[model samples]
Target: MPSGESGHALKVESWGDPSILVTEFPDIEDFHGQLIETVLRLEQDPEFTRHFDGHVGESKVYHVERWDCPAARLIDARAKALFTSALKKENAVVDLSWASVYRAGNYCLPHSHFRSAASLVYFLDLGDEEAGGRFLFTDPRLKICCRHEPGRMTYPVGPQVRPGILMMFPAQCVHMVTPYHGTRPRITMSWNIDDKALPGNPLPN
Candidate 1:
């Protein structure tokens, strides 16, 4: 993919009722390498804590406010831009930012982010395409699942997973990841954001 003068190529696509924004950053090899290394190093640090909840299975996810890495900041800027463009709202701020590292047998259950106007997931390293860690979004309506035929309703549709692809959707959209079976780890970064700054959660500097 040919990049712009700034060496950053972006392509944005939006769909669905609430609108899901899928942005492709096709030229960021160096930035991705730096970010992957940074996250791996942090994982090995004894002081860096990992978080787990009922929604995740054997995966490492943690919040970070002080991660001032240039690659991360670049992602933040792009996310804010996409948010504003899609929602026609300005001064959007990231309420929470986190990184997720998933090994074999790791997955996330269907859930939605609360208190957020929107949320995004950036695919850093999707290990194996056939290893079955596809991201899925369930239809919010209960009537969709009642159909007897399988192909009739496309409720749990997902985008093609690839590196440097960022997907932003409404906060209420319930999404999840299937169990991964690849030998290599699957890595991703996420953010919970709103149109404006929240009371206690401030934007990253």
Candidate 2:
């Protein structure tokens, strides 16, 4: 388990063959309001359009590291710490950091971030509990989906979605989000991190 800045141990739960670490960020009520507002504002920025690619209607992924906000900075710092703890290395660097806001009908298709060593996601908002935007991981063994038994197709994996929960998993793990049906937007921040810096991709100063 990783200790917070105040020296309190943060609870971490791990599961699955390759293992996924789920940690509840301490005292999220302190800054979630500000963080959510910042994310919503960034989602509307026209500049993010240039960075858009892949699924045409998926939520826009904005590089929030360039923004000079305390909420974003706090998330970046905590994400890097969690990434380092998950990799068991002291020098983890975030190669890519972005935030996404999922409104009604927004969903991510199955994809993998094969370029990075690991990936991190911080749930800023989960909308309604009944909303159907659960994050799921496809069984790595493609043949497993051919089985007719229950729970053999895809794994919901990780803890239930809620604000302040941070999950770190292998970058190559295939994952996707279910279509969201809530009136309120689902917000999340993500980072692609590795033990060492990449060649062309420079770490944010």
Candidate 3:
């Protein structure tokens, strides 16, 4: 939360897997303002549709790749710091980055990112508190339980729906979003980092 510092880390309860990390940042680097503004501007831009895809018309998967995220530089540095600190991967570079706007009825299907060591989702804006739009992740233990398990998480799904929150996990983890019925739109930015991208003293690299 200091100068040149990234966001404040939040605790992510872990299970047996040590390669897992679920960190929450408290907007320590001031990336939230820029992140939200970029999406808002894109929504009004005539060509916004051309630069992004997913949930464009009939589709519901939001993805923007032609232009890097507005806060790419800051995100890159902070993300590297966090990833290396959590996963011990250094010299990390963002291989892919994009922004998405989720309006009413928009939802993402279950999927995992490919060709990357980790995947991150930064919550730029959460439209409504009652819209019931929640981030869902598959159980890491491969459980198919429809009910809660004892001495552990009972549900097979995990949810995190909050603004100014950044969620990171293994690239191979499957996740999705529930339908957003809120009147206001939800904005978010996501990216993946390749293990091969990091190869030096992360700070100077």
Which pairs clash inside model 3? Answer: 55-59, 148-154, 149-154
Question: Between 2 and 3, whose lDDT is larger?
Answer: 2
Stretches off by above 4 angstroms in model 1 are 1-9, 15-18, 46-48, 53-65, 141-155, 200-205
Ordering by lDDT: 2, 1, 3
> Cα RMSD for candidate 1?
4.6
Query: Each candidate's root-mean-square deviation in Å?
Result: 4.6, 4.0, 6.7
Cα deviation of 13, candidate 3, in Å: 5.2
| TM-score for each model | 0.81, 0.83, 0.69
Off by more than 4 A, model 2: 48-58, 141-158, 201-205
lDDT for every model?
0.72, 0.72, 0.59
Tell me how far the alpha carbon of residue 38 in candidate 2 is from the true structure, in angstroms, after superposition. Answer: 0.6
Give per-residue lDDT, candidate 1, residue 37: 78
Candidate 2 residue-pair clash tally: 0
Decreasing TM-score order of the candidates: 2, 1, 3
